[model samples]
Target: MDPVTFSPPLYKQRYQFVIDLVKKYKPKKVVDLGCADCTLLWKLKFQTCIEVLAGVDINRAVITDKMYRLSPLPCEYLQPSERPLTIKLYQGSVAEKDPCTLGFDLASCIELIEHLETPVLEKFSEMVFGYMTPAIVIISTPNAEFNRLLPGLNGFRHKDHKFEWTKEEFQNWAQDVCSSYNYTVEFTGVGKGPPGTEDVGFCTQCGVFTRSYQSEGSLTADSCRDTEHSYKPIYNVVYPNLCDGTILRNTVISEVIYWAESIRKNMVECAQEDETVDNHSYQASSKSVPSVSNISQETCSTEEHVLTDTRGDNEAYKEGNTIFIPLAKLFSFSKVQKLCSSLDHLKAILSETSQVELNSDATAMILSAVEDIEEHAEACWDTSCLELGVALAECEEDWDEELCDS
Candidate 1:
């Protein structure tokens, strides 16, 4: 079959969502499940610095063609031009394959769910989540409600699609499936625009499942009470926007954490046995002890508590733990800033010389950090500034007290 072509608007929106998710996870490897023509994989390989991109599909024809095309090149070959992205293609059902064996940080199943049977769907979820343990998984399908909205004359039905679900149905199913495998699900789509907007119509339903946790056990009998009886008009109900690009925020954060952790690990590994003592003596001689005030003691304490909480629970870590230790706590901001500055300086020097050395690890690390910074910055924007408001009020109170004393 010819590859399914998406409308430009729809394809771009979906691609953005996937890119955000990938950046958030910053997975070393990525796989596209049921990748018909492997076009997505090809695009992703060209776009991201992910170590590997594997495309899997059951179609023998696509796989045979891909193999024939790629076989001429060695197993790994550098492009004649400076191409940053790379991908490999495979042939198999997700239900039958292990993504971990293939080494994927993320797996995508765009427009593949509706074609699956329940048992196969369960198997497919298990195969990916159990083995790959990717930080993120993205899936998209047609929104059934939008299909209903289509005139019957549109003839949009596919012979292979066993079922099409409305947003509600898709959300519930995604939640259930993800939860079964200890994953959190977020719903997005081509309609609406983002998560919560006024526009609601036929658009592709997109679901993102992440290996993250939130506080639980808050629900109570009283919480179940529904007092509002009057029905609101459909116009009053705000239709949630589909993926609004923020989906990439999490990917960015994950990448940052990954890079930060990696850098810390490398530094620790390289440190001399007496380096800490030597540094301490040097600081003492200089009479300039580094102050801890720059770091949030509270945040550090919270992270430590979380680590302690997980110490005995190996299963919990495997499930998904988002409680990350901020790099600021582990490393001096001044040192990090200096390092970044030095890197920038080096880049300029390399450009001047026209002799750019490709440090894949360093490049990946920097990209991850950039993504993380962007993700958290966006998150901070979304939250109301109630704490800031309280702080301002307290400042006013202190000012009044100072004036009275004066």
Candidate 2:
């Protein structure tokens, strides 16, 4: 099945909406359900001062170190700052009952529930309301009522989406959940709708549920346990230190950071050994040939030999440089600086593009630009650098492929 790809504009709106809510709520413990690539977590970490951030995705592939590094949101973005973000990653389906043991102040599942079958969604509601009741729950799903706004849009926005609820259907569900859980819910739409359909004109609908004061006391961990809800520790961080792009991409920031570190250490050791050998040779030559005439002849011969071997040594050095200097100037410092600038530009593109409707042509251009960056990063042969590019490129490629599928 083809994967679902979200538009840059939609992503921006979703992020901003969630970010605004986070700012308003000021929840210290945040949980992101279906946090694929943990994209929002990276944003929230910088945008807010959340004490604990947890990401749970059903796709186990995303939990692996390889995918985590290659799945966008670079290591530099997830770095330690003056106000550090303590992040935890888990792999498990949200359909499971009380998937996580820890309590959260706020929970968000953006553009996720539609992908689940109706039955799973029912269980999900139970999991969220009946068992893992947080103080606040925020959800965003595609609005079936607004599919008419999309050009050539058919059936559902994505094939994986089991169903998209109309505004009434969504409101009904929200009201039912709130009533059952003794919570109060509010509604908002994400995208611009037709002029006449202002109230229900959004491409996506959002529901924010805040538990009532009286309900808080009854919704405890002990109460959840009484319901036979057992929390599983299936979610784990195979690689905790996924680089966020603040550090040099060549260092210990990739899936292969350990290997790269070892190779770099060996290279340093080899260079040191070569320096020692050269020093010993110079000392031995000076002691053995004490005569001034001999020294002079020796110096003349060495000069002559160096001049003769210079061209050959250069050719040999160029060939041997890869082995000797893995981190050695594959690309100039200027090039890396330019690449960093280009990445900053790409970030601008992401922000700017989100404000307007995205087309296939624009998507192609964006993907091409990201690929160009990735290609340059790959030349450095640093997994951290290469994977940063890989993540961006993959994100675009997935979008392109999904567009084709659409």
Candidate 3:
């Protein structure tokens, strides 16, 4: 569970820019996404003149009871009645919707997106733009183009990164998210590259999104005004990385591992249940138990077959909506891919072989269900989950006939 080390200059520049943004848009409530170890907030609370600071990260180990017992610091500007700076720390995934009720003025997720897979990244964006809806959101990720400048840099910036995007890919994604959320985006890069490639030279790229909305009670385009600039940075923090040589664990990849383990545990339980049933039947049959040699051989063969079939079934039943074992193990990252593939294959089979005869309304419902499954697969990554698809398909009685004939 070692944390990955980041380039000092890369992080320093990123933090400085974030601090500048805070100073420009002095927000009262500040939140940091993927705030591993809460070190970033520690620096901010100590160095900046912020009224409130909160850090949220998925790492559960660092957020101890002692960490939450933050000591209050003296405030010179306090009106003998005002409380000092308030600090809150949460342990949860940034990719998921934030559980806190309080909204934030500024949210920062520094060098965290690359670690997430595509589906998780989409959810992360939705959480930021749709749920939190902060006035300003700052996100940073490694600029894949700059890897050439670093002589020792290997495949990716970190071992945990699922994929790295070029400048164009990152900008395209940012533009789409901003447009969907009514925000304007500005891009900046950190680190030096070749002299001529200023735009793509930075080892890390950051995007600043400011929310823009139309005037209250006015729907006209002319009435819309940019309001994000009203917020200014209240704090200027400068601190070197001061933690011990502890490598940050990749929560993103660990999530996948945890998922796989859960699936395996369920499969094991299912197998044990089946074995118990078999044992009961054998005992009731009025026959003595098998010899030790026979029992050992039988146990070995059954276990070997179960293990072999579990893996083989996943690969072999790729086109089916149901499988003997957990469907999630069929795909590398998410189950949605497998579901999509199965749906597409089902469509092709129907088109080439036989077709279900249904009324217009029933056909519409079936088609709508297909679309729903696609979106559901993407959001939940539920693999081999075709309950909706099958239910909708069965709405037309002719489907059963057509399927049997095919």
Candidate 4:
């Protein structure tokens, strides 16, 4: 049978609905109960509000193969996360009580309930809503009522689905679970039918169950940090954040190098324009010095933060194949407004790191044996920031593979 596809696609719509909930409630800890291929877990990692992310699936092979997709991207370093985010993928059954997946703020089961047998479903209800008892529970299942709207369909949507609950059946089951677990539920769905098919509801039915912790003395996240150790470790990674000294040093130095490289490219362009007006203005053989024209003098040189060469003084200088970039010019480069929000924030971070230091007057940022990026650009723009590019690439490659053994 051909796979059933929706306008936005049923799975995408379902994941988006959950992402919207995550944005609204800002849950710090979230776990996907039946993360088959980990597509949902991969998407949730981009949501910065979630600090602790986890995925539990019975299919260990799939989790192990796809877990690398959850790692931090290279751009994440240019602007680090405000809060640290750690992601873990576990191999386990949702029916069993697992300490590794416990005490989450939000629990998600997307199109997973219908796949469970009746006996397993009962256990899942108790384990997820009763023992774990997260503040919010989101569950989505295929709506049997909407099956008629699908083309060339049969008894169930998928052969693996033991049963598909009708709207009443799903809601009644939800209400019963809420009543048993002391929680309230909100009903919603994704994928609309034809204009007049409102009565049948969406293609995928969802229930958002919320409850406030009572006097039963629920488990705090720290309580189950280790205890039976129910879920088997698959992969785990902690993203680089500013709170650590070494990570901060690496992050700051890389940012400064890239920033300086970008400004150097612009400087080369301005120097070319200045060299056009006066043939003898710049002598690369003597030292890196470029004369400034009236337009440059009025617009850039007098800005106090832009490069200065109007009076024959070089804003950037070369000595024995080493070059220095003025911190004032780099931090105030007109183009950097798009790259950084607050230059002061970078300055503070730099001061905290010992790897890179400012000159005595704090006027220049001295990088040792820095090759001319202009030469690297002769190959391509990609090679211009070689030092930073290699650093970031090495870091990302570490996260590109499975982080845990078995």
Quick one: best lDDT, which candidate?
A: 4
lDDT of 1 by residue, 1-406 (tens): 2223345666667677777777776776787777776556555654445756667777757655544332213212111112223345544677764322334557788888888998998787777765455667899998766554434525345788878887788888877877676898877776443334334544788878887643242222333232221111110001111111221222223233434445544434444445878788777866564764656889999987896786542121111212223233322334333333444532333233211122333221221222344354344433312333354356457656744553
Model 4 CA deviation exceeding 4 Å by range: 1-5, 74-83, 214-217, 221-227, 258-406
Query: Would you list the C-alpha lDDT of every candidate in the order shown?
Result: 0.52, 0.61, 0.56, 0.75
Least accurate 10 contiguous residues by lDDT in model 4: 376-385
Candidate 3 runs further than 4 Å off: 1-8, 47-49, 63-70, 73-83, 99-101, 194-199, 214-406
lDDT of 4 by residue, 1-406 (tens): 3444577777788999999999999999999999988999999988979989999999998888878888778777545665788888888888888777666899999999999999999999998998788889999999999999887787898999989999999999999998898999999899988777899998999999998555254666666654476677777777756554445545455556666666556655666777685565445433544333424655653674443334223266544444567665666664443334566655665565444556666656664444665453333333323544565567556756434332
- Over 54-145, each residue of candidate 2 has an lDDT whose tens digit, in order, gives 77887766555333432224444443233434566666778776535347888999999998888999999988876678889999998887
Question: What are the TM-scores, per candidate, against the unseen true structure?
Answer: 0.45, 0.51, 0.47, 0.69
Model 4, C-alpha of 363: deviation from truth (Å): 6.1
Segments in model 1 whose C-alpha atoms lie over 4 Å from true places: 1-9, 65-86, 99-102, 153-156, 191-202, 213-406
Candidate 3 residue lDDT tens string, 186-294? 9986666655657555778889999896323322223223221111122221111111011001112123334433444454567679989988887776366454355
How much is the lDDT of residue 353 in candidate 4? 48
Number of clashes found in candidate 3: 15
In model 2, the runs with Cα more than 4 Å from the true position are: 1-8, 63-84, 99-101, 194-200, 214-406
Instruction: lDDT winner between 2 and 4, please give it.
Output: 4
